[model samples]
Target: MHAKRKTALAVGAMLAPVLALSLPASSASAHGYISNPPSRQAQCAAGTVSCGAITYEPQSVEGPKGLTSCSGGNSGFAELDDDSKGWAVTSVNRSQQFEWKLTARHSTSTWQYFVGGEKIAEFDDGGAQPGATVTHQVDFGNKTGQQKVLAVWNIADTANAFYACIDVNVG
Candidate 1:
């Protein structure tokens, strides 16, 4: 009985490190979609855009107080009227390539976009309504290990705030 107990304790200690190493890392960054598997046959456009999955994060704001009844004011207001921010982290092979598509929605308003904190694109939907989607394609460039990416949205201010940001990975 003493021998059996000693063996059990030794086994438990040996397994601890293996179990801990298998756990996933906790990070606030979002993961992007991977549309295609990494392969030598894969080619990027102008060596900038690559094949990869796309993910989206939605955001919104409150409508203006007195303008509640105003046209297009029903869907609340948009914060970051000029710029909103989002982030993501991805693990990639040294030679892997990827692209991204982003979108925004508002019934009575228009929204602009930025990547890596730089203005890259914009969309003007007529009103501040919903269901509006914008798309952009970007190349991951050359990267290894884990990489960080950012997306931002800009829209007019009102009552409710509106915004969406997403991150993805391609390897």
Candidate 2:
């Protein structure tokens, strides 16, 4: 009887560990999606114009980093204008209560931002090469209207070609 009880105890101990391992694990919640247009190819044209496919991808206000690139003869930088060949903007929110992600790729280049044809901010990652994505949160106060955000690569060392990915808005 004593030997039988010891074997039963050992079996219970092994089964206990197996039962614990079989339990399901928990995971973190995922962020919601942002509604934007599709991805389009774009190339830099004149100093104040860009031509190619145009689309937007909705992204999370807070989540994993996104990627964008422009290589070969295709440049991603473009001037912000009302004309057909320039950077375009779609207002996510007029009150500026949300945040968005902007990622770009350029061959030793920088980006310039404009609102309503006026310079608002400029970013270059301190002259880094091979390019990477940079996130920016914009605030437009409590006003309600369409605000345009333009990205222009200002690098002259080599031909600048790049594209931007604007993720979802965070409110």
Candidate 3:
């Protein structure tokens, strides 16, 4: 029985790495989100607001490109679209530096920012792969008061994009 147990242990050890490699990567390893100024998902992940699955996987708010919703049209993260959730609003100057903390940095196409359904800023990455962290300095122009800034990271090779909505009071 001891010899049989030893053999089982050996087989288990040999299969461990293979099993790990064959398993799909978790959403936590999939992508990224706005960290600084804390987008809705970031707020969930940080426990600034109580939430559901998103609290564990803030970087997974990915969907097809050109989505304007905070949840990126993903039903699972619909809590992000709730305006009454009391999402913390950051106070910023006319120009604010938005930062993304990436988990799996994919090749990029463009970074876009929108306000009131109007495109306010866009930074073209030209299909380059970004580092773990990306920062964009967005100028709010004359826009002020409470605003929701939708940020999108379009993947160069994929038809999808990661989305984040930052709530802010532009000073």
In candidate 2, list every pair of residues with a backbone clash. Answer: 37-56, 59-167, 59-168, 75-161, 76-162
CA lDDT, every prediction?
Answer: 0.33, 0.35, 0.94
Ranking by TM-score: 3, 2, 1
Lowest summed lDDT window (length 10), candidate 1: 38-47
- Per residue, candidate 1 scores C-alpha lDDT tens digits across 1-171 of 999999999999999999989998552232121223311111121122221221122122223332211111323212212121222234544333333222333333444333345444445555554433333444454433433333323334433332232233535
lDDT tens per residue, model 2, 101-144 = 23433333445544454555555655565323344444444434
Error of 1 at 46 (Å): 35
Candidate 3 lowest-lDDT run of ten: 24-33
**Global Cα lDDT for candidate 3:** 0.94
The all-Cα superposition gives candidate 2 an RMSD in Å to the true structure of: 15.8
Better of 1 and 2 by lDDT: 2
Best by TM-score: 3
